[model samples]
Target: METNGKILKAGIILIAVLVVLGYLGVYLLTIKEPVFIKHYIEEQIYTGYQQGPRQVDLQLYYITNAGDNRVVSRVDFPEYPEIQVPASEYGMHGGFMTYTSGPQQTPGSVKGRYSMRTVYLGFSFEEDYYEETIEITKAVIHLSDGSVVETEIGSVTFHFDEERSEVLESRGGSGSGALETREFSVKEDIELIEVFSPILPVIQDSLEMKINGRDFKDIEGMNIEAGETFLVEANTQGSRGSQAFGEELRYLKFQPKLRFISEKGTEETRILVSGWYPIPNYEFIEIFQYLRQKGAL
Candidate 1:
């Protein structure tokens, strides 16, 4: 009886040891490694001239390894610098409203693409014009590897126009008071390329803009009336190449400024706009297809 009991006890110990070893092996195999995120800006569009809400569109791309490796949780873009202008200038003001987009969710394996839309409010005046460039300095990506990578993208130019009409005796208005209407068209010309190790430039084949504008209210204290509307749009393309691991780089940064100048009764104003975007590879391919269809290639 004593011998039989000893054999049973030994067998139980052996099974327990095997189970522990199996668990350890599984844990090691499931361990995750740091992943590389290739970021790209697909498209950016801005429409600044409108009595109603202006619009801005940003398309972004995120790429990673195709496995249970580390995933991208958050991407931190540099804050757009503040623009300080006096309130008394032009008796008008301009700014942006709360923008909307899908919640920044966890990145999946392979690639993830997203688009964000922002609404802007133009200055309160009969007519307003604006011109600016959107530049992205660098994007700081947080990885499950407990690592952060800063990468440089590029810049793009944008223009804005806002027009309002005074109620003439012909139009329906009380005592020459004009009512604003939402109506405008946008035309854009943009070319963008991803500069990795080997630089290759790709021009945008399509130059037609098809974005419209909507009505908005005065959020800023600029006491401006709503009227006519205008729109802005940018269509871009991107390609990928190998990049060196460590290198000094200069990224496009967002630093917006507004200046009102009046020379000899000629009034002029300058506005600055900046942001970041990521274009997916499929979208880039579609751009080429579009160009070829139009015989632009």
Candidate 2:
């Protein structure tokens, strides 16, 4: 009876020891550093522009264990240092708006390919946190042998909201190359009146306009009225009498002369005529908005 009791006691002790060892093994495999490691960024935020001296900040969220044992991630930004300009640069007559880039001029450097950067998330253990800092446009995760693995974790992006506005602003210009001019004749018996608005390069330094080989005094703050048809001519500051037309960028004076034929039955009455339009191809005018948006002008 005593031997049987000893054997029973030993059996119970053995079973208890085995159970404890099994639990420890499972714990090590499931929860310890023996398993896979993952690194990832969760989210990011972009702050706006700064005047004169400025710095942009990006916030990133990170996590581990992306469903698999991965240690790297690569991210690419095609639009880096977004192209943005001030309102004044767009040729809008207004207050001063200045936009300047970095000392090395890093604005819009990514030609066909954008600026790039890489993040190196070194080996990580389940208990370890993976980390790095990279100032680049492209990012990637890879094994030591350079095998791309999706398991690697991390996220990177710009503080885009504020910078995005800059790219939207730098557009719009009515320059020399963009205009199409045309001439028309008025009757000798009819009187014609015209007025021009402020010119580009400014009225003081811009092109001088003439009619019928006679230099009409610029009516600043007043309108222009003429009699009959007159030869229209334009010249720049240094080269006077050079009717090279739009060579020098100038603002078309507002309110040009208007004329039209009268009705035979109403010979005693005057013809009501007004308004003139630039004679450029309509298709080109249609593209102005697109060019302005793209900052191409």
Candidate 3:
């Protein structure tokens, strides 16, 4: 009986030792293994080549891990967010074009700058959307620990057309007959790049205007007040082509209508984009935060 008890005790000790060894192997292989994960960027700096008026390619990129997992992302401007580029600063020969007020043909573009240090990316809105730049209007990023970082996604500003042409809006002079006519000095290549009506559907025919005073025998079908420079465009036949093309739009033409009116009256124009316009300002901290939240950097 004593010999059998000794053998049982020995076997129990051996099993306990084997169990401890198995646990140690697992701990060393997985539980205690150091994970060396890092963020790898293809380019330290990003530049977007100009595509056309009111549109540019953001150079989309993919986030990849050593395991070959990937996520795709691209930069974009907010929908009709208010843009305020001051004149004499962002190269705005014409300054501060807002949805409610500002110069016609305000120039600007939205750009993005990314960083891993912050929870967000950086943004720069410039005047001449064609120029290559490091400045951005939005910034975004994320870290390994699951902490998020980001900033304002993008911005828009106004600029004056250096090549703007002169025009005349006249309604009859000293004449027995009453007449109204618009005259243009030359062609005005006003590019309407983006539109945003957050509160309403993106209506293509919400307003109307006549370009270069070419036609306006009382801009019928509008409820605009006489002597009101604002001409409400009830029909934007010219912009329809752009709408049909959708995201594939390159450029479109617009004849400047001196006046605009909407069925709602007191019409407002909301377009947001980024680029150095009028001048340059280095304000792009908010955009970075936004990018991280969306997992776009």
- Highest TM-score scorer: 1
Ordered list by lDDT, greatest first: 1, 3, 2
Give the candidates in order of TM-score, highest first: 1, 2, 3
Write model 2 residue lDDT over 196-262, tens digit each, in one string: 2212223323344454444435422222222333344443232432222233211122222222223
Q: Write the per-residue lDDT of candidate 1 for residues 1-297, one digit (tens) a residue.
A: 999999999999999999999678445333132322233232222343435434343322332223434444445556432321122111122312323496333333232121111111122211222444333445555555677766443432233433221120112212111111222221121111111111112122111121232111111122112242233222211122111211211112121222222222222322212222222233433433332343333
Show model 2 residue runs off by greater than 4 Å: 1-183, 192-194, 199-201, 218-229, 236-297
| Better structure of 1 and 2 per TM-score | 1
The lDDT values for all models are 0.29, 0.28, 0.28
- Name the top lDDT candidate: 1
TM-score of each: 0.28, 0.20, 0.19
Q: What's the distance in Å from true for residue 275, model 1? A: 20
Total colliding residue pairs, candidate 2: 26
Q: Which lDDT tens digits does candidate 3 get at residues 205-283?
A: 4222333332334434433233343222224332443233232211121222232333333333311111111111213
Candidate 1 global TM-score: 0.28
Model 2 TM-score relative to the real fold: 0.20
Better of 1 and 2 by lDDT: 1
